[model samples]
Target: MFTSRAKIAQRLLRRLHGTNATPLAKRPARPSVTMGRALALGLGGAAGLLGSAMAVASLESDDAVFTNWSATHSCHPAKVYHPESLKELIDIVATHHAQQKKLRVMGSGVSPNGLGFSDDSILTMSAFDRILHVDAAKSQVTVESGVVVGDLLSHLRTHGLTLQNVASIREQSIAGVTQAGCHGTGAAIPPMEEQIVSMEILTPSQGLLTLDDPSDHRFQLAKCGLGGLGVVTKLTLQCVPMHKLLETTTLYTLSELKKVHASLLVENQHLRYMWLPYTDKIVVVTCKPYTDGSPIGSRISDDIEFRLEELRALYKQVATVPDPDHVNWRFTQLRDSLYALDPLNARYIARVNETEVSFWEKSQGSRVALSDDVIGFDCGGQQLVSEVAFPSANGSDLTFMEDLLARIERDQIPAHTPIEQRWTASSRAAMSPASSPLQEQVFSWVGIIYYLHEASPSLDAIKDAFVDYSKLFEDVMAPYGAAEHWAKLEFAPRSALERHVLKDRLRSRFPLEAYRTLRNEWDPHHILSNDFVDELCSTDL
Candidate 1:
């Protein structure tokens, strides 16, 4: 287990190396200058390269290293500045301000968006990752920016506390999660950032500023601020006591799935489901709070590696052989197990298996086959993705889903993958791609994936077709107000984003004008400006 500080430093190194043209050590450093004195010499943007080697040895703790989820990104920091304390963070920000380089705060490198990296400087709050204060009476905990969600949860468990909700993966940095406005399903709930009661912001002009009482309009707006406002050094999150989850999983026919949806929701504390498009069936997952003398269940011991290998075999068989549908059946049996069992029992199951049957067991992670090593395999490298969320304002309904599946089968689109469908309640965060005003709106998330028989095939010809299909689907879901996920491929043109979200409304909540004022007020030199944020805000999409 790596210390939080060490982990953060490693991630910085990875980020730096990932983008740099030359490998880190071989790259020449700027002319001689001290770390702090280097700033005085007017070397801001290029200083990160020099800072990388220095950061590796300066980690504050081992707990810090365990905080990072990906080893690939651990050694990429242009400069890893780990302040021994929060006070140091203020000085670092102020120093960068003087040097004319915008400073970016890194949480965990979970986002594909290049927001966390910059040519200037990067600051990691690994040293400050601790539970500063926990108020059990008020059900709140003040956490440093560098803390990982899983670590926090472990500590909270000891204190009989837990976050009201968490994302599928708990490896995210506390500061990073809030900065990106990560969220989960449910209408009664808000995004993770919404739980923040206050934040300690380390800004250029105002050092160690605290935004108290996030319920206030200013605080709420800044809670989801895309790190353009300032580096969040710490956060105060509202939490609830730990509780056992009683869950249930059931397969429903298309009509039954639609009919029982309401009862399932009203009867459970948490609900999510998956659908195999064109199959007329949906996997229903429902979880409720269990307060009885329920025993904690044991962790699963599934042969995940073997299963992944089998999946690769299935994909290969489907691609080269004629038993494509058989492969699909096998995969569904494995994937559906995530929601296949009754919540009240201690039962577990593999909800989905590449094989055609669903059985009891624990939640199984998504895995696809690797055809690279298979003998006689000729397809070039294939990319697999899971892109699902509420349909856009233009998506179709059950009929559309069924029709698409039938069409794929009829036309033999060459892309043979089962479309997984899941339903989610509305989201309150304005920036959420799936934002909706009606809390009870049920939106379906459909994923379309393709595996090829050749390497690096051109997707241009299929792009137009995908757009047409997405538009039709979006039109069907318009009344329900659906949206897409950020990281996945999108069919909605940049123009639709403008008209759909009412960019003016986003500007209002994000406080674009005020943020600009704050940016100018805090970072007068435009040190932190990046083409990514600029393009995102400026683009019609």
Candidate 2:
């Protein structure tokens, strides 16, 4: 039924967009048979046998080295299983545990890390995607773990309901995003995992476990389990009535932002700022609920597209230039050209201004659209990213961020991508960077991205430069009690984690002991363990 409905939706979307391009929904093929027997059969008699058969039928011998969306990490798994039902998932886990084989769960593989990789077997939740129930009165929906955020938002739009917040990219699976501690910009909104009211998990030791009560200690542990606890089968999420949002973007100097940062946070429902590398210019985006019947604005305007194309062309030209001196000259010219385009660039003389101003002008605008449409920004091509979260010294000070920026400039790091800053409320999830036992009202998340343009001949050089720059980044952030985002480019080993300056701070902030206890009890045999999980959990701190 979902397949046919999805096909019809694809056709309609194609007609609406006036394009013959194949829809994203049509990219992945589904299997013929679903998992398990009806609930009437229960868990015994023919039901158990049927479930096992289904699991076996769904299993495929996959020996390919799976690469993540960013093409950053790859791992070869022995086999892959696509279980469509709770019973089948339980059976698969049991079989894998009995065979003493390790297992990992993957959903769309949007994370840049190697979290979903396993040498033994991988269980993909894509087949289990479905919306089981919706309670309009409570403004809640129950969906399988594999449901993508974009699809979920679209489904909820028809019912006049939507998630309270979503990350910049909507392609990640709900379970994937939740477990990885994905968050968006807003002082009131916590990570996506906070929206999950309850979830059903299939564990090797425990056949099927339902965590419904938010008061339960285990619920907090399981919310951001890093895929170390078990496989999440389904989740019940709290939602709000659908609404439109007004988005405004403008260019601000770093000095100017420092003064109004507090007011900006208070005035907007969602706020985020981007700092261009090698420059002091920042692009500030503020979004708030819009109630007036203003016409919806286009997500991307022609002017914005034109600027982006020009930037791309400039980068392409730099890649082809053979002379190092000429390349450096082009870089300066490109920077100057970008600064010239900014309306605010005229305030500072070209020679006196050392702040980067490119791309800020293109993104500046005011648009009123559905909250989801306005919030979801493009992920921008294959890239590597590192996002770190640190506690706000005060609710409104930008001293720490200012110091960090100065250090980057002093060190002369070759960072070209924008540094994004956003705020989030404290979370209850044990492993979340934003988690706080004190229930802190605000925390700052800073993200640094590096685009790995595949077509560029200087890709190798860029990667090398990023590696050296990242070491300095880690060193500078270490003293601020910063924690790396679970799904980003954090390759620190167990030894390094123990030695980290903020190790004790993180241990205290996150309920590390309690989480370890619960994880051990649920996954005694470590069937879902991977190198990353093991290293992370092995930290003595």
Candidate 3:
């Protein structure tokens, strides 16, 4: 029952790698623009000085200058190559391998930690975005690495199929999500990397190899291998039958959350908690699959029209203060700060958080929507986020949450609202934070956020406060068997000892030496090695 969009897109992603491989003539390739004429997207930093340090403009000598979605990371590579065909990609890899050059493969550049940044030869997966095959009987679909998650979901909708789980955002590349081990909130669902039925990786030394069998050690390691062993060109993913979802957003007190936390996971198919800091408020979101229904309630609040006015008021207040040039009236975080009398004061921020609790109380309701539409939520503007995963206990990780909140309040930190906690079943990917040989174990992910609203005079000070807040949580969570999410692991500045300690901690949890040995076999010359992966391979520990 595959329609043209589903049949074609699914086939478009896989057919390019078949026995008689040929480029699809239906969809035209995305043409690259020359330097100085290409898009100059530069975001300096969540920190004031860091933002100004990035040179957003492209140089005449360079093919293109790149910055990540959050602007936390940027790079000016010597050359940027776009290979439209698999044969062309193989040739490029072979040449880079022969020269023993540092060639890094990139996706949508959405990683906040700047995983895609490279100073040497940079290759984009932009042109490889096609759905190559679909086997409805097996509930599987094949796609090229560059295919955006949003587009893939739209295609699958037509075929009455959808992914088992997806991250909160849809703008990222499929390969990036899988490699970074992104996840959705579900006690039974594993991280997104578990969707990979097989991946066709273009390795420097091995030419092309498919990691298909789950029992194979290579498949487990390379599934979330941090893109070291090879460049993943295409993958076959397991999909489920399409279904609608009923979502409800409800307000709760911190005590109430502790009481009902275990029951929430047992009752709902997907659940996430937003802990409003400095206030005794928590917002619990639950989504359950539904057979058929009309839209029931409004997820949108009645005061939506006044959101901009609240932002303008903050901008006006920020502009009149000392360091007048810092607040950008145009760049806003309406949900982040509705009313901040004093943006950095503990007592004043608590009032703002209380106002936010009121806002959620008003906005709380139930609604029915398609799974794809409901799963995607607005992540808001550029922000600095750090998330850690720990084994789930008694249905939730409230013990860790209560400890962290106590520390934040005791220190009077100017933390933001809605510090979140989400759950996922463990993954088979060897390096994943929730790594396990079995998928039955559940893990809880807790996150702290500091919104990077543009032009705030208090930006640097707020960032400093976050450092203390996060450090305390890290120290407390160590005994609970915690590990930072792969994508957000190295975002903070670390000293040599800190770096060595982090490396050692990672080695203790993951199969670092074994992975390193396998990587040496697949990419002996280290042509595909990037900074992140190189750090893991280092023996300095």
TM-score of each: 0.63, 0.81, 0.86
lDDT of 2 by residue, 444-523 (tens): 89887666655444556656666666667677777677788888745552256434644565565577777777778888
lDDT of 1 by residue, 1-541 (tens): 1234333334344434213223334212111111321211101112222223442322222212211222111223344564545556666777778887755665554543334544445565545566778888998999877677766877777678888766554656777677766655443445577677888776677666778752454465456666766778778999987776655456667777666655665576555555443345555555666656654354333555443454444344434443435343433332322112211111111112223222322233221111111101111122233344553222244555665556544543332234544445544444544445666555556655433212223344334444444544444444443443433323234476544454443453343565566666756765555444444455353
Best by lDDT: 3
* Candidate that beats the other on TM-score, 1 or 2, i.e. the better one: 2
> 383-415 in candidate 3: lDDT tens per residue?
777899988976449888888888889988767
lDDT of 2: 0.67
Question: Looking at candidate 1, what is the lDDT of residue 37?
Answer: 16
Of candidate 3, the 10-residue stretch with the lowest lDDT total is 45-54
Worst 10 residues of 1 by lDDT: 370-379
Question: Backbone clashes per model, in order?
Answer: 60, 2, 16
* Count: clashes, candidate 3: 16
